[model samples]
Target chain A: MSDVTALHPGDTGLSVATGRTEALTGIAAGLAWLLAAVAAAAFDDLGDWLETQNYAIGVGVFGLSFIVLGLTGRWFPRGAAWVTRAGPWLIALGLVLTLWQLAAAKLGWLPQPFFPPPQGILEVYTFEYEELASHFLASFRLLAVGFVIGTIAGFLVGVSIGWSHKAGYWVHPVLRFIGPLPATSLLPIVFFAFPSSWSASIFLIALAAGFPVAVLTWSGVANVNTAYYDVARTLGVKPLGLIFKVAIPAALPNVFIGLFMALGAAFSALMVAELVGVKAGIGFYIQWSQGWASYANVYAALILLALLCSGSITLLFRIRDRLLSWQKGLVKW
Target chain B: MVAVELRPEQPAASAGASLDIENVSHAFDLDGSVLRVLDSVSLNVEPGEFVALLGPSGCGKSTLLRLIAGLEPPRAGQLRENGQPITGPHPSRVVVFQDPTLFPWRTVWNNVALGPEAQGSLKQQRERVDATIDLVGLSQFAKAYPHQLSGGMAQRVALARALVNDPEILILDEPLGKLDSLTRLTMQSEIVSLWRSKGFTSILVTHDVEEALFLATRVVIFSERPARIKADFRVDLPYPRHRGDPRLAELRRESLALLGLAASW
Candidate 1:
C-alpha cells in the first residue's frame, strides 16, 4: 500500500525467510499427515488408545499440545505472518497430542469416568472431514450472498446521501435510528418475514454488514472538495462526468475505511447466524463439536476460520491499494 | 510546438483607450458608523501605460485595484475601458492578488493551464499554457506541486496561470508584497522586464514608493485614509532603471514625503 505505507526497507531478508519457512512448514505438514496415516494404520493398539477418552489422558494430551506449540513457535516464518507462522504451531501441537494420547493410554494415566486420549477427537475430525465440509458450505454460501448484497446497497446509499443535501437530511436520521439497533435483535422478527429457511440469518448478516459500507460511502462523498466542483464547472464537465470523475475518486479513500470495518462485521454476523442455528459452516462445526465434546475438532475449526478471515482481509487491502494508487502515503492498511 | 522561453517583444504603443475614473468614492459601514475609505478619487491610465497606485497602509489602494478588476463594484465612480463601462471579471482583464492564490492541489503545469482550459476544451488552448509557462520562466517547475515549491516559485506559477490566457490588462494588487526583500527585489525586476518585454497594459498597486517610482510610467500617490489622489507624478526613468540611482531616490523621497512619512521634499 504505497499510499498508506512509509514502507521502510520492508526487510527483504524477513520476507525471504517468511517464504522459506512457509514452504518448510507445508512440507512438514505433509510429512506429518503421511506419518499420521501410516502410524494410525500400522498399529491397531494405537487406534484403540485414540478411541479411549480418560479425562487425565485428555488433559495430558491438551497440555502436551501447548508445550510443543510454545517450543516450535519461532521455527516458522514471517515472525508474524500468522498464516506461515501459525500453521506449524498448530500442526506440531496437533501432532504431539496425537502422540501424547497413545503414550498416556499405555502409561495408565486414566482410571475411570473418562475415556482414553486423542483417538476420539481425531476420529471425528479426520474421518468426518467430508461431513464438516458439507456443513461449512451451507453457512459460507449464505454469508457470501448476504455480504455481496449488503456492500453494494451500502455503497449506493452512502454516496447518494453524502452527495445530496436533501437525501442526507431525509435519509440519515432514519438510518441512524435503525442501524444502531442491533441487527441480531431483528432475527426473531425476520425469521417469519421471508420464506427461506435461513432468511433471518441472511437478513441479519446483510443488515449488520451493509450499514458500515453506507456510512463510509456517504461520508466520503460528503467530504469531496468544493474546489473540484468549481474547476469542473469552469471546464464544462456537467452533471454526469462530474460525479464519476471528480467526486468518486476523491471519496474512494474514505470508502475503503468503511469497507475495512465492514469485513469484520460480516464475519461476526456470519458467526451469529451460525450460532442462531444453521445446518453447516465453521460456526455450526464449532457448535456440533461442543455438543459432542470434540474439543480437538473445535480447535481445528477455529484455526481454519481464522485463516480464511485473515486471508480475505489481506486480499481486500491489496485490492484497495491497487484502486487508490493516486492516494499513496496517505493511509497504511 | 515546444514552447520554453518567452519571445521578447519590442516596445509597442499601448493598444486600448485610457481608463476614466471620475469622482470615485467608497465607504464601509461597520456596525452603525459609516467609514469613508476613498473620497472623490479620480484618475486616468492612458492606453499601454504602466500606472502604480502608491500610498500608506489603509489608504484604500488595493480596494481601488479591486474596483478596476471588477472584483468589487465602485460605489460612486464610473470605471470604463476604452469608453465602455466596466462590469464583472472578463477574460480580457485579470487581477493578480498580493497572495499567490493558485490552487494548491494541482501541479504547477495544470495550474497554469487552468486559465486557458476554463475558457473551453479547444485544442489550441494547450499552446497558450505552454507559451505562458515559458513567459514566466518556470519551464522546469511545470510538474512541481505547490507544497514542493518555494514562495517565489509558487507566485511565478500564479503569474504563469494568469499570463497564459494573455489577458489584455493586468491589475496587480501588491503582487510582490509578501516576498522577502531579496525575492521582492528579484520579483520587481522580473515584473518590470516582463512588462517592458511584453508591452502589456498594466496597473500595479503598492505602498512602496521606490517600487512605484522604478516600475510605473506614472506614479499616482494617495492621501491617508478617506484617500484621494494627492499627487500624480510621471517618472521618466527608462526600461531597466539603475537601482539606488540618486535621481530615482529623489523621486522616492518625493512620493514618501507626499504620504507624510518623511519631511516634505
Candidate 2:
C-alpha cells in the first residue's frame, strides 16, 4: 500500500472514464426537455388521465429525471451542484405530485395508492415510533444472537476442515449428505418441534447462515501457497502453531468475505423465521399493520427493515475491517 | 550499532563445520521406474571451509545441500555433523533459498530473528537480530517487508536471517543465481566477505564454474543426474580474484573441463 502512495489519482484505474461522463450529460439534457414537454402538453386536457395512468406518471418522472441527469452530465456530472440540485428538484417534484394527488383524486388522477402522500408516511414514522422501535428491537435481537453464533461456529468448522486432511476426511462424508439441504425449509419443522421463543429464531438464523462461512473458510485455508507449509515445516513450527500463525492469518481475508455473504443470508433467514409462529419483530409488525389496514405503518415497517438490513451489513463490514486492518482496503465490497 | 571488523580470515580454522557424508544416495520414482538423484555422493568440509558444488540443471547439487541441511534424509547413507547422523532440519544448519524465501508477513528484523528466538536465549537472540541486521547492511530496512526489498536485497536478508542464528554451516541453494550479472558479482564478493568475517562453513550450489572458482577453496563438480562427485578441484587463488584474472581463469577452465563443459583450452 505504501508502495502505491506515489502514483497519481488521474493515472489510477479508479478514476471514472471521461467518455462515460460526456454521454450521460448528453442524455440527461434530452430527457429534461422531453419531460418538460410532456408536463406542458398534458397540463391542458389529459392531465387528469395522465396522472391516473401509473405508466404515464412513471414515464413523465423518468423523462424529467433524465433531463436533470443530462444537464449534470454535460456540466456537473459528479460535482457539488449536481448533488445540491437533486434535493430541490425532488422537493419540487414531490410538491407537484402532492398538489396533483389532491386535485387528481377528485378528477380520478393517478391510482389511489400512488398518491398516499408524504404526510401519511411521516405520521407513521413520528407518531408510531414507540411501536416500531419494539419491532425493530425484536428483529435485531434475533439477528444479533443468530448471526454471531452462526459466524463463529462456521469459522471454526471451516478452519478445522481446511487445515487438516484428517478433519476433512472424517467430517466430509456427513457434510456432503447434510450441508446441501436447505436449512430454511426446516424452520417449519423446528417451529413445530420447539417452543415458539427466541431460541427457535436464533437456531433458524444459525442453521441458514452457517454453511457458506464453512465452505468459503475451507476454500480460503486450502488455497494458500504450499510453499508456506514448507517454510513453516523448515522453521520447525508445531502443528497447532502452523494452523494458528500461518493458516489463520492467510485465510482470514477470505473468511471475512465469506462472513459478509453469510450475514445477508442470516438476516433474510431471520425475517422468514420471525414471521413463523411469531407476533413480534418487523415482519410481524408488517402483517399486523396490514390486517388493521394501516398501509402507511406497514410501508414504514418495510422501510425500517430495509434500513436495518443495510445498517447491519454496514456495521459488520466495519467490524470485519477493524479485525483485519493488517489487510487494509481488503474488504472492497 | 556495534560494528566489529575482523582483521582478516583464516579460511580453514573458522569456517563453521566438519561435515562427514558417508555414501549418501537418494532416489525418486519416475513413471514407476526408480531414478537416482544422487549416487553415493560424499564430501567433507573442515571448519570455516568454503565449498562450491558446480553442475547443470537436474544435477543433484541442491539435493545434496538439502541432504546436508537435513531437509530430507538420505536413503542409503549417513550425514555426520560432529559424529552424529543428521536428522531433520536443525537450527545449526540454515538454508538460504534462491528466492530468499523470507516470510512476507514479518518485518526484516523479525524474519531474521526467527531462528534465534526459536532456539537461543531471548535476550541474546534479540541482540543477535540487531547485529545480523547490521552485518547484512539492512539496519535501515529493518522495518521493511521482504516484498518491499529488491531481489538482491531480499537475498541479502535471507543470508542475514540464516546468519542471525549463528549457524554452524550455511547452505546456499543457488541464493544469488537469479541476480543480474553486475549484482551477481557484487553479491558474490559480499558473500565471500561475510564468510571471511563470520567464519561459517558455507556450501554454495551453482552451475557457474567461474563463481565456484572465485568463491570456493575446493570446487566440487557433479554429473548431470544421479549426480556424484565428478571432480574436486582446489582453486589455490587468493580472495577477491576477478573472473578475467589469469590464475582464476586457468582454474575455471580446469573445473569446466572436469565437468566436460569446455573444449581443449
- Please report the candidate that would top lDDT against the real structure: 2
Fnat for each predicted structure, in order: 0.04, 0.11
Instruction: Identify the runs in model 1 with alpha carbons over 4 angstroms from their true place.
Output: A1-329, B1-47, B53-90, B95-105, B171-174, B205-208, B220-233, B258-260, B263-265
How do the residues B57-138 of candidate 2 rate in per-residue lDDT, one tens digit apiece?
9887788888888878888999988677889877678888888777666788878776655553546567768878888788
Instruction: DockQ for every model, please.
Output: 0.12, 0.28
- Among these predictions, the greatest TM-score belongs to 2
**Model 2 lDDT tens row, A83-180:** 33453564455446445544434344545443343344555776789989998998988888898898888888889899878999987677667676
- Off-target runs (Cα >4 Å) in candidate 2 are A1-116, A192-197, A277-279, A315-331, B1-15, B30-32, B117-124, B263-265
Per-candidate local distance difference test: 0.71, 0.74
Docking outcome class, model 2? acceptable
When summed lDDT is taken over every stretch of 10 residues in candidate 1 chain A, the lowest stretch is A46-55
Q: What's the lDDT for candidate 2?
A: 0.74
